[model samples]
Target: MMDKNQSKRFIQFAAECQSSALYEHLSLHIAEDPELLELSSYAQKGQPMPNLIFGAVHYLLLNGKEHSLKNFYPSLVNQPETEGVFTYFKDFCLAHREEIIPILERKLVQTNEVRRCAYLYPSFCYIYDKVKKPLALIEIGTSSGLQLLWDQFSYSYGTGITYGNPRGRVHITSEIKGDSTPLLLDTAPPVSVRIGVDLHVNDVSNPEDKQWLQALIWPEHHERRELFARASQCVQETPIQLIEGDGVALLSQLSDQISTDSLICVFHTHVANQIPKEAKKRLTETIQEIGSTRDIVHLYNNMNDGDLHLDYVHNGKTYNHTIGATEGRGRWFEWNIVD
Candidate 1:
């Protein structure tokens, strides 16, 4: 079990890596403040404490909470106040202790980063190439299910060429790192069905849910905020089947519902880290069991390590490989798929 100080330090390093100066600075201060640390203790087990606390504060601010802390947020103000933010942040949290605690206790750090679709686009293409079947996407921890709509969005990997939906409303751009390039399809592969299962499925159409998701985005990430808004609009417009339950437990039952003609592509990104070790083992076993019957592909990361992995069972043979590494936010990815 990670203590409060360790969690705070983890967030501090993570924020620095993600280039969120605001969070990096705040986390440093929060680590030293016993009161704020105590308040953060309200977060649920396995939840990222920094994200929960910051998101709670952002949710309140977006809901029109009046506070000097608002001045420090780039998402709220044109010229955000840079200095003495910790004092204002501490004051705001203390003042709204009652309101913040409920959010901290209830909400999970479930960010549906649309940009992650950059890598998903190619991975799905690879699946389609191998099996030549429409994909049945079952996303575990699909908060708001925006990523399930990857086919409906356009993408660019720092190249002049455009891919995916040409007329896509949400155009995602990512940097292609490393020397090797993965397969890129001129168009998205056909998706037969999209099913998202989560402990608490967030409905993007709901005002409160939408606000909470928006709050999850870092205050300085203007591009991410805009992408989220666009993707949320897309999610509301699209029809996706969302189930409320433990995704790992429901995998087999859900797989039975999909037509055998479609390739079963079970996937989750940046979500498995929160799952219990035992549950993670069960999830892998379940996927293997499902694979024994028919062709299935599992695309995931943060299970054994942070690198993106592609494990597919094709024609009674199982092949597993590390596809490559990816940025936390999908800002860039290295496509190292060998043949």
Candidate 2:
């Protein structure tokens, strides 16, 4: 169990990983109140802390913790099922705060074991058959550009739903009801082109940021890191056009440049939740405007303030909708409008 001293140490270490402004921001909102800080102190000590807590901390650091705390954490800790995990963290924080804090910082910002399960291949395979011909792919939230390798490899799903090699980081295991499966193209189509955009892109080979990416990985799932490393290996050779600016702005630019003669697939994954409401609105509007004539495919979690589902429209009509889940795991429902 973590003691208060330990708790203090962890909080301080976490503070070090972030800038002063970030720490203060989180302290005001999410990490505010003695209990929350206490809980946080403990949570950092857990062997496999709840995803909710880890996600909360990540969000807090990125967004202001205090401003986002109430909305994000809510009363999740009080729930009966979460009591045990809560207690464990509380104790750990109370006991080993100092040791744990540095350890977590090291794990989060300096390791590679956390970079697994790049879930990009599965999503690509899902759309491969729809736009079978040669195409250019653009990805938003392209963290580390691992998905760019989609055009370079193949994947075999554990079940019957296998996709041939030259796979990307995403994978698909969930069953689909549709009669058609992804058709195999002669080749990945020369990437015609591929690019990635993110708020901050981790250099997989960079010692420091590599640790940060590793920290982002869930420790409980050992396979995730392995998968990410494997995908990373392929990405070294893949050509990725990385743009380091706002995705919404980029989409608007691409909307005008896309060639109708060729299919342009603009996609994303499990990243929408991190965007602010206003940003999301702009993104939706951008896509709605662009989808009128182009083929845009986005696979991202709808789990945000207003909606936890993704809505797609083609030619001003709804084409696809689904409740996006983490790591490409969950149910997907769609409605297509035939031209």
- lDDT winner among the candidates? 1
The C-alpha stretches of model 1 lying farther than 4 A from their native spots are 1-18
lDDT of every model, 2 decimals: 0.90, 0.48
Off by over 4 Å in 2: 1-128, 160-162, 166-190, 303-318, 321-339
Per-model TM-score on C-alpha atoms? 0.96, 0.57
Please estimate how well model 1 matches the true structure, expressed as its whole-model Cα lDDT: 0.90
Give the alpha carbon lDDT tens digit for every residue of 85-142 in model 2. Answer: 4344334344544544554433322122212122344444445555554456776777
Clashes of each: 0, 41
lDDT of 1 by residue, 141-163 (tens): 99899999999999998779999
Q: By TM-score, how accurate is candidate 1?
A: 0.96
Which residue pairs clash within candidate 1?
none
